[model samples]
Target chain A: MFDIHLDFDLLEKCNRCGACYDICPSCLNIDGYDPRAVIKDILNGNAGRWLTSVHIYQCLECHHCLEICYQNYGFENAMTAMRLRAARQGIHPPQVRRGWDMFVKTSRLGEPSLAARKKLGLPEPRESGKEEFLKLLEVYRMRRHGPSPCLRER
Target chain B: MKEFAVFWGCTIQARFPFLEKSVRVVLKGMNLPFRDMDGFTCCPEKSLVNNIDHGLWLLTAARNISLVDKEAVDLVSPCTGCVSNLATAKGEILSNPRKEGEINSLLKEVGREFKGTSRLYHLVPFFHDEVGIQKIKQSIKRDFSGMRFAVHYGCHMMRPSHSLKNDDPLEPKKFDNLIRALGGESVEYSTKLMCCGQGLDRVDQHDRALQMARVKLRELKNTGVDAMALCCPSCFLQFDNNQHLMEKEGERFNVPVLYLTDLMGLAMGYTPQALGLDGHRVDTEPFLKKWKEISSRPSAAAAFSEGMKKEGSFI
Candidate 1:
């Protein structure tokens, strides 16, 4: 039931516009990183190679390209769509899997550290929305349920 | 100063409770009507949650936001990811009636509704726009007159400008404005707008994450700034914790990291211990030491201004 759609119209425009190339943090700092090249591959339907590549993960989702993009369609949208495809195919890095499991289970990446909070003299943390969130997730999954193979575990 | 709920999110309270303390001290010191509310989850950390399940990410963020909507209170957060995620979801839901109805109906199963009315703000913008810089200046007890700071406006704080619209995104000035209002020099550098690249750590590319953090840290090391100031826990983690890791590997990028609130708490005369700054991975002692040395000395410019006032002379 889950699906991601890439806009070739925007992608074509992004391919033509190399303006974001100079502005994307990854394109500038990370060597051999180019989203325009990825966009070209995407247009050519050769994007399967990117799902397993580290370059997909390097986009940083910083939205630098979005802010600087002529079409407001930065490399991040394409990168995010690819990552989602990779994740649905269960191609997540172990840390992402661990993080996803925690989010699904706890409704948060973590609970407040009791010992640390006590030592710091901070107030007891407000109650987490764990139960309600799980219920909400249940409702969400019921409606939008798909073969979410990434976090396949309950 | 409308009452607001502080969405501390997962990171600050869990991995860095001290950052929570710093935020609390500033909130209390400034007498803002911020409260700790119940039943808030992760902002679902857009990169991780959204990548896996876009609907789940939006739903989770909508649920957390609906809590604030239930109370008819505004929402504010210190964490960039939390604010960004919430605002993005709010923007998405508000702009799409179908999505809003769908999410709200789902939320109804859990006894909440998304009115999509509560204003969401990151702390930097909240202080810059809502709290007013004049109030900030008036509250300062010991300003950082001679101190130099590299302000890292974490990306999510202002980007995706369509959603957040918090600043110029490309060339933000609020954090720098806040720093200068507190009497510190906001150091300008070429890599100033560079993302902290903390997202790499979440994907199991710890080495590349370090490589990303190193890019900025290595540059700031020689910029001669006392500390790198930022607002997000993720960026804080990347620069402070990761920098400490690199230091262990003999990379001496001795730049201290400070939260915007941490600097504010200090400038407002809160002690480092009271502000919970000692909990940071990199020691803020050197920055504190230099600040002490710098603020203790009478300001030459202040003296000149005072003498000019006394002389009542105009050239």
Candidate 2:
């Protein structure tokens, strides 16, 4: 199983150092969207409150925080961890769920448009690694959860 | 120049084939050694896959990089997100030998291995560094001497700088350098480095996405730029498609967005139609018309010399 551990040591410093607050797009523009608050909540062991909060999903994943962070562990990590936890609880936004489902199923969010390619005189698109991807997915699921229930049903 | 595989990524192939067209046109025009390799999947976008399943995110990206390693070619992508995710995964794996081994053990079943030898590059930097500004200036047929462009260095192109160390994450200069090399002015703005907020649209926050786009578009509109040049499909979607959506709602932020390749192709003397620029949602006509008018005009020196000739030059 992939370990989803946040480095509390770095996170603790992140809480004390709000260097990225002035730079983060979400924190600056989105009201009530503060990574410092999220980090504080996470440090205090009150992260559950943010699981259903829209603020968790507000991070644009732009990595500006990572760039500006003195610790090199931007608030994005905290936001990502919160998001992962929220997703684990099946509490992420609906679109994220849909995007994830599509990605897992097709190994791509969408396929090349054949008609558009023909009209544009573009060459035929190379084959996608879907079958191998699905196999890999199954293996990953099995590794994470012994004998993936979905895999067995299939 | 080393041979490289072009990772077009999902968004460009699926939604913006025209962007793929423009990129291919410019690469071929420059005679760059880039190929479309089969058997690659999504860079498995970091936000989507990493947030949900970090392991699968790592595995998928490793598997993709392994494809390039197997080919013994470097990887270059027009999509910022693809390069960022692949490079991030490659960096993560290389730094953690145990994790790398775990990923390889998983990949061994698929008959692949992540050597992580290939260099990952976004197209803008690829052109700026590997392709070289001097070479591009020599290759182009025309220049945008009189035009001004806003260069949107999409966040992924540089940020999380430890992994994708292609450019300075905060004060990037490569895109601006490329634009200036094309004889265009890189218009400076407050939100130039701001995230396009395209990610918000992905999380069922369409209104917020629009707000984020408005932040930049309003600024660009006020700045009176000829066009907004970018290299990422997501940023293109946010500025072009979302801007179009806003226009339809009677909210006009009619800033035309151009892919870096589109601008480069135009400088290389390819017609807008040939570059499939007609496919853009926000009209590029105003920008095109202005450029044509500007290019047709004589230089100030030439105009002064002609006037001197018309009247008898002073002793």
Candidate 3:
């Protein structure tokens, strides 16, 4: 049941450490993409602003912030928690939503390109973990709360 | 060399089968004990699946790892995302016996168990650490001598440092070292270690994705490098596919992208056609032509220096 926890202790440390700001690709390249602002809001219990903001998704999950953080707990954790919260509420980007849909239904983003594989002389693709995963998810759902909104029809 | 299963993650199989060809060609050339195993999935793609359902994400990764765990074979993947996600899940479970117990209980009902016993590696580090550069250098039929390549270390290849502890997360050298082992210059640039920004595209920020791709491609284009070499399919998509779209829109960043094995396959005297280099969106002709022109010369150092002077010294 680990759904992107935001340990305030680490978030507080991340808030105090600006080392990542200088190194995070989004911070340096993408204008107005500030994780510090998001962290401040999260610490103050005002994360509602970012739950719907694309900036939370903009963190890129690159782990550069994690690499640079003195606490090794980058603002990425905050960003991830926020993104998951938004997604659990069905407020994520449509492409992400579509990708999520495909993933759950097929256990893969896309199937092996048969024509491409033949052309490239690649061997047959091995079996996927779809059946096992679906079963495991069913068991997981039965044990946990009702199916997360992620699997619910919008 | 121990036997290991090759996790040909979703993107490479579904989108870039050519990259699969490249990896196979190189692995066969090296005669490594690589096996193809069933019962693996997307690595469940961290951002998409993990963002939506963390439990499902972890469970899927655990299940995928367990396939090899049962066989007692190690896992290696060309896709950095696959390796990273699988390794991250292993880390989570190994650190939490309670969570492992919980996930295992559920997996048991599915006829699987979560055992984080097997080792996981991205192909790049596996080659660097296990295969050893000496063997790689010996395997080269024609090395990339005197050629300059900008190596794009797709972030997941070596970040969240604790989990993928293969290289320095910020200042990685394994990919560069591999390039150099093939006798090419791993050109250093400011954005060398930057994330490929492919994740933005998955999240629907297409323009932003292109913008991120542009930042690195433009730098490489201006720097006048021969080609961009990377390992991740997502990074390849960002650089090759996104770059093609950018150029199609009348932008002029023509930095050709090459995978690590594509470079190695070429070094092993495999034809670009044989290695599936023909399938790349951005034409690899420029890279192949330059590699031919430089390596063919009797004096490669002279060719390298002359080529640098001709580029007017951003070198």
Candidate 4:
């Protein structure tokens, strides 16, 4: 599940322009998936119901829409808000849901195997936390939104 | 026993260890020094797929790069995603002093700072640029003169060139040049500039990914190339994995997917299994067998680079 960031001005800019629908690689390629519908939903003041689309999780955030939009609407921002809204409502897909768990616990999406790194001719992993810097970001994220759901379980 | 750092992202280690094996064999043949840090984390390219906060992605990326030593000059990655992610952060943070200060401040808290401005190179370009194509061309004991290949450049290495910045974005064919140097024919096609749909991995959208890959493979296959050379493991997986998905959906393409290093190793006479040709989603065994005969007997028509050079120089 994901929510698009919809400020009043940006919302007003949608203008029901079909360019986003026409240009979206995801929408065009899949069945029953339309970003314009999400925009329409947002414009209609139904943010909560928009999270039900499995289509929301498919956006690559390439900013193709943002780059082409006539109203200068930030589609990627809206997409991000949709994703966060979905995360808040527990709508994440299983793979992403599992990955979110792993990321928060280890602060790693997934660890490449040690043997694999050796074979790839890559450097061994090293410690790199600016311990204080990480703490501050965590605190900031926490204060802004009390304990991220991704990190909460971990 | 080389002296470079190992910058493994998720794909090579988890999904395609054969790519790692090929890289080792090729680097060993080239005699380049390298190392892998013991505990590096994800480069945050996946999270970015979700279009997660850029600041978080940057910090996570910086934190990962900061783990590398101050002395290492280049971080070689088998996965283009990792290379692109690091290149994006490094370019962004280093190019903007204000961003650098903010990143450095976060880094300092973890007792780390990215003082090292080492450029990140996807392994293919590093070999083509630093190792010298002429040098590699001379080392071709097993020439692939009669074999043809499609060079899959993968997007992150080129696009949004503003952040990661392609040294030669407009003309990204160092892989073709290096491929030709190995006695292999680099097949050019109309869709060479399109992506392999690897950029969709983070969002878990299989159909979108499949469709994106379909367009590129469809065009590459039409060119009648023997195999496709990959610089990134993610692209490799997407292109390779989607071949099966397409087949399940009744679209069949029997092209062999290969890492640039795998081709290099094959040219150096490494065993097919040693190079992990069998592990590919699209079986490369047929191409590997064909390559053996092609390499042993150079064709007079192996004029890929010569033809390109005659028209205009390829970057």
Best by lDDT: 2
What's the C-alpha lDDT at position A31 in model 3?
92
DockQ of each: 0.73, 0.83, 0.75, 0.28
DockQ of 3: 0.75
Kindly indicate the candidate among 3 and 4 with the higher TM-score: 3
Q: Kindly list the per-residue Cα lDDT of model 4 for residues A28-146, writing each as its tens digit.
A: 55678666667677777886787866667766654446545666554655666787777767777766777766654555655557776575445554553334434746754764578
Give the poorly placed runs of model 2, Cα more than 4 Å off.
none
Specify the poorest-scoring 10-residue window by lDDT in model 4 chain B.
B45-54
Write the residue-wise lDDT of candidate 2 on A1-154 in tens digits.
4657899999989888888888889888887787788889999999999999888889898988888887778888888899999888888788889889999889999999999999999999999999999898887777778788765888
Candidate 1: tens digits of C-alpha lDDT, residues B175-205 = 9999999999999998998988889898887
Q: Could you tell me the lDDT of residue B110 within candidate 2?
A: 81
- Ranked candidates (TM-score, high to low): 2, 1, 3, 4
**lDDT, candidate 1, A1-154, per-residue tens:** 2355789999898888889888777787788998877788899999988899988888898888888887878878899999998998999888888899999999899989999999999888889989988877776776776535544675
Candidate 2, residue B53: lDDT: 85
Candidate 3 residue-wise lDDT at B175? 92
- lDDT (0-100) at residue B13 of candidate 1? 85
Which candidate comes out best when scored by DockQ? 2
